[model samples]
Target: AGEAIITPADKKHPPTIPVTGAAVTIGVELGCAATPQSLQINGNLSNAVEGSVTPSIQGTGTVSGNGSGGSTGGQGGGSGSLSITPGLSATAADTVTTGGSLTGDIGPGTTRDFPIATKPLSGRDGYVVARETRVSVDGCLGGAQIRSYATAVISTPLGENSITTYGRTLFIDRDHPGAPPKLKPAK
Candidate 1:
């Protein structure tokens, strides 16, 4: 909210001053983006079980994204924060502004929504699983000219035990390309 004024004021005769000053609002645009991700398997099983499994896992390849952008603006001398200095004779703009959002369903990673692979095991037989994920956000800091708010919710519990007991992995090498052929049995 701003102020209004008049001059030569008496009980019955008051001067009429027109309203004035800069507009009270602004707007901006926003967007989202993503990148490529992949996985490779290596390593051999030691003391192999007397059973076998055939697996067929399909993956979604690399990805990218874009988003819309807008700005919060006012009718002023410059693009700095919006403020006013009250005095006898104040000057400003009467520009009215609206707001907009720059949003995209984008990130550094993508969901492999489709099931990758399945395996059937006999008694005392087990399998392995590996997961790698990265997340980030940009250009959303709160400032005098721009304010930002973000909320993140994770349904997955936090801990090693959050994973299914038997479907978990015993070892893996995310950076390494190949696994050695010989592995001593898991005592």
Candidate 2:
């Protein structure tokens, strides 16, 4: 969603030093319910980072309804976090970057963790600490199309002279006639 960097005041040069770190924790969860013709699902994912850099990520999603024939509805949401250490490999071109990816269902009472590959850089070597969270929900009412929503956030540290950027994606699906396609037309 959003991120901020804290710089050490003692550093002589700007806060633009390379660093290394690792994710020390990961967690995930899932929930589901079904009737004769209807069904409901929810899940979530969370992660923590330590070592050279520290960051965290979390998300939630759900899917439910009578796919065969009936009424139903669903909804979902999620977010992410990250942290970075400075001066591990101080260099003129030192820099730090972080990012992650998420898929599947995420919702309440659900969480999971994923391992990210560490990259080695010349001149300034730094670690990438990152995590991601996702959530979703879906359902249908009679012949009407059901609805679902999902959200995610990611954060990372940057060199004093560097900048960080973030983005997200959303998908939906329905089986009713006149139902919109899984991917909405770009605005």
Candidate 3:
């Protein structure tokens, strides 16, 4: 997992104005038997100014998972990554970028979520708006399913800004028998 920042328009500003960094933390809990877990996180921030416009881009990614198994128990693992980019086209405006990701696996099932935010960082400043999220899942008893949600708002100092939000959910279950053991299928 890692993060990065790109500056394509800020050659006039000092290099110190643009910086990037990332960090990650992981935790795991097991009831019994052997369990393995791992995690990674990363991100970046950058900005550039050219003429009367400033452009900035930032991104982040994370991956984590756990697995456990006994004589009959099954093992599971999961991971995911996300990123965002924001830019200001004119000198009289600001831009923001944000994103998140998650993934997990349990037994014969898997789940994932991805969220993104794009808007002005400040509300009292100028017109700002944008939001988005998505989710997906798969199960041994079900096949595969996906859902999406989004929101956006535009505001100005003179009046109030418009607001919009939406959400969705999905589910699936299917039976899938993996390859038999090296010997033969369990009776």
Name model 2 segments beyond 4 Å from true.
Answer: 1-111, 125-165, 172-187
Q: Rank the candidates by lDDT, best first.
A: 3, 2, 1
Please give the RMSD of candidate 3 to the true structure.
Answer: 45.6
What would the TM-scores of all predictions be? 0.14, 0.18, 0.19
- Best-to-worst ranking by TM-score: 3, 2, 1
lDDT of 2 by residue, 101-126 (tens): 54344333212222233233322223
| Deviation of model 1 at 160, angstroms | 28
The prediction achieving the highest lDDT against the true structure is: 3
Pairs of colliding residues, candidate 3: 3-43, 10-48, 10-49, 140-174, 141-173, 141-174, 142-173, 142-174
Give the CA lDDT, 0 to 100, for residue 119 in model 2. 32
Residue-wise lDDT of candidate 1 within 130-161, one digit each (tens)? 23322233432221111111111112123111
Cα displacement (angstroms), candidate 3, residue 119, comes to 2.5
